[model samples]
Target: MCGIVTAISTDNVVPVLLEGLRKLEYRGYDSAGLAVLHEDSLVRVRSAGRVAELATMAASRHLTGNIGIAHTRWATHGEPSERNAHPHVSAGLAVVHNGIIENYEAIRERLTAKGFVFESETDTETIAHLVRDKLNAGQPLLEAVRLTANELEGAYAIGVISEADPFTAVVARKGSPLLLGVGERGIYAASDTSALLQVTRKVVYLEDGDVAELKLTGYRIFRPDGSPVERTVTVSSLSADAVELGQYRHYMQKEIFEQPQALGNTLEMIAGGNTISPQVFGAHAGDVLGATRRVLIIACGTSFHAGLVARYWLESIAGIPCAVEIASEYRYRVSVADPETLVVVISQSGETADTLAALKHAKQLGMDKTLAICNVPESAIVRETALRFITRAGPEIGVASTKAFTTQLAALALLTLALAKINDRLTADDENTYLTALRHLPVAVTKVLELEPEIEQWAQRFASKQHALFLGRGRHWPIAMEGALKLKEISYIHAESYAAGELKHGPLALVDRDMPVIAVAPADELLEKLKSNLQEVRARGGELYVFADAGSEIPESDGVHILHMPEHYGMLSPVLHVIPLQLLSYHAALVKGTDVDKPRNLAKSVTVE
Candidate 1:
């Protein structure tokens, strides 16, 4: 994922763009660049590291302009290098882009045949040349951008500025996120509102197939066919304090502890008294519930895990036949879909590339009842779908998601209850019980956080291990997968998760004394079966760290350490059990000397494929 910011102002815009880039750097940090229209020409500066290096280079020389575009890149088409960085320029136009261009190779070859030279291996460089070619053919700047956008064949949010039109900037989006911030003197465009939060509170989220022309006065939106479209500017309530970690040592830890409050706020909005608002479900929920014949859940990464859990809840509680698919693979397979099918896409960042693609693909297949469960209120995914439910997890700074994942689960649980109520599947007693359980969740989460000290003590025993295994059954199986993912993502340890019953199939052979086995042993109907699975690992001489419910009998073994968590109500245990896993991974990564906030080769948001 890359970050892009552009400003059209009366004063010089380089300093403002640099500030915006610093705020947006969490999206991507491979390289950074800025291009400004200066003295009837385009001036460009770029570097191959973090934004600090680029700022140093920019400080060495004076590059003055009132309008410009900047980028912090996460390389996709080429390796991270100075030449491969963004702000790709040709003649008078300078461009910065986020997302991939699927047809760049074909377009590059055609341009090469026309005797046009290339500068770098980035797919974005091809856009600059295409715009220059259009201008060379006697097209105006707006027409050139329109033609170039029409020819591109993949996800992108591109910002374009030209010396020929120094007072204006143009932006277009297909799959990635882009927002226009309305201000008094000028307008701002960025990949996310975080970049513009300091300057303006009002924003217009650009829709797919929409083009924005930013000028000194204001910006204009147009359809793909050049038809004017009017949009309302919504004011954002996100403050600067929300993005800060406050007094916490790490963002992951802060986010982990914020779960209880975030869930409480979400529940207050949905289940508060006298509020029977279906609009909270989304604008198209009525149409979707009435016309839907089946349901499909699509997502990637942690959101995929949430969807997997939702599948169980939806099928068992709501009596809806549901199927869950990883968004990356969903589009490749030929599946049955129609106007009656409701496709639900889940993602923390609505700009997740694969999920957005899956959403568009579902729409193309005539699945009009598309709903998105996302954290960002005005993300590209929210704009593309007719229905959306925004998670109240303010802003997750850690590269590995903590609060977002849990908040998504909480939201999905609400959706399940809503479905049950609408379908007459839940009686008054059942509804009251579910709501009561939900209201007590924040307190249960607080009790779960008390297990941190014990988890940290257990983490020390496995800090030197080369590999690990996690096991669970039923709903906890997804939690097992998520636990293993968090460990591998941050600790750089080889970890694999398996269903407790499936351990003997082939994964058990890899277990040894040097390998750590983390078992989720919450007290449930399948507790005895899970205990037998734990015995199998013990027999294999696997170093065991079991997270069990309070008062549960964890058999004494020489190398086994039992972490007794507070007893939680059934179906609410997953939320409690996840706390220990998070603490284990966090402490393990801290001991291993890994960056807890910014993991390697990963960004906070996956806006590009």
Candidate 2:
């Protein structure tokens, strides 16, 4: 996915465009470019690297314009090069685009037959050429953009500017994120609200097939059929200060330590209650969740792991049948969804490509009862669903998620309690008890964070290991899987997680001295079984690394090293157990000299498949 920003102001727009693009750098940072109308002529600058390079080039060229559009690319259709970068210009028209054009080849061939020559290997160039042709044929600027939007297929969030109508900047979106920021100076269009936070707090998020026109005075939006539509402009509650790194080594470390406050904020609405309330979800939450026959959770990456953990909670506590599916895998398969199914979607960025597709797929199957557990309140998932819970985990900059994951778990636990109350499976006393646990969570998490120094030493030991195995049973199995995923994501370690009982089947043979085994041993009923599994690994010449809760009675020995958790959190053990795993992976990646925040081949949001 690429980030696009467009600004039409009274003064020079290059500086504002650059600042907005910098804020959106988290969406993409491979290549950067911008086209500004200077002296009634379009001046386009393209750089083959980060936004800094593009900013430097624009500064050196003295780029100045009252109307401009900017982009930071992730190189989807072509390699990252100056020519392939965005702001593809043709015939006085400039365009910045995100998402893939499914019919790009066909469009290119048609444009080529019209005697228009191509310049770069990007699908975005086709839009520029097509818009140029439209404006050449005497079409208005907004009309040309509307016609072009219908011509191209697949998802796209595009910003288009032309010398013919230099006062207007047009932006449109279909199956991708785009928002309009209403500021005192002018109107701004960007891929995320974060981009406009520095200039404007009021924003209007575009729905699928909505086209907007940004002018110096104001902005106007329309539906796919060219009919004028009204959009609600809401003030963003996101603080720009949260995106700053006050005193952390990296965004990953900062976000990891922010879990307590993030989770507390997420749970604040329902934590002080003596009884669980369905109204916490949304206006129709009670009716929708009350009629739910089964639960289906769709998500990707760390969000998917959170869904897996929710599956156990829903089925065990709420007495409902729950199934978790990887959003990417779920979209391709046939689903026999019931009309009474509650399709819950989880995402941190809320712009995750496959998860959005899967949500649409479920809706297409006539499952109208849906809920989105998301971090961003203005995200597409929140607007698409009838119910939502924004996990106020505040701007997770790290590609490897930390606070976002734990906050989702806390929200899911709330969902579990609310659903249990509806089914009468949970007593009023039980609700108060769970609420108390949630209220105490911030303190509990602070205690867990105290083990970071010890975990860092364990990470130092883990830095040299090439292969690793993680083991947990029942509800903790997903925690083990998440731990392994974090290690592989940042540290580049080859790791896998297996249920403790599954170890004897086949994984025992791979447990040599070269491979270390990490176990999640909570003070639960399954501790004895997990301990026996650890013994199997130890006998096979594998070093055992155990994160055991206090009262688990797991003593450290010569080959088996144990990190004692200060307390056992009963049903909330998974939440506390995951902190050490995060610290371990972060410090391990630090020791291995790997990218801690922006790991290779990974972006913060997966806006494309």
Q: Which candidate is the best by lDDT?
A: 2
Cα lDDT tens digits for candidate 2, 1-609? 678899988878899899888877765468899999998889999999878888899989888999999998887888889999889999889999999899999999999999999899999999999998888899999989999999989889999999888789999999888999998888899988888888889999888899988888788899878999999989898889888878999889999999999988998886656777898899889998899878999999899999998898999899999999999999999879799899999999888989999999999999999999999987888888999999989999888889999999999998999899898899878888888888889899999999999999999987989899999998899999999999999999999999999998999989998898999999998999998988898888999899999999988998899999989887788999999999999999999999788777677878888
Give lDDT tens digits, candidate 1, residues 1-609: 788999988778888899899888766478999998888688899999888888888888877788999999888988999999989998889999988899999999999998889989899999999998998999878778888999999888999998878777999988888889998768999988888887788999888878889998888998888888988799998887887778988888898999999888767774555323356677667656756666799999888888887887888888888889998899889988767777889988888888988898989998878888999887878877888888888888788888888888887887777776677787888777877888888889888898787788777878888999999988888889899999988888889999999989999999889989999888888889998888898899988888888756887569888888777467767777777788899999998888887777888778666
What C-alpha lDDT, on a 0 to 100 scale, does residue 320 get in candidate 1? 82
Instruction: Give the TM-score of each candidate.
Output: 0.94, 0.97
After superposition, candidate 1 runs with Cα above 4 Å error = 62-64, 270-280, 283-294, 338-341
- Report every candidate's CA lDDT: 0.85, 0.90
User: What's the C-alpha lDDT at position 210 in model 1?
Assistant: 83
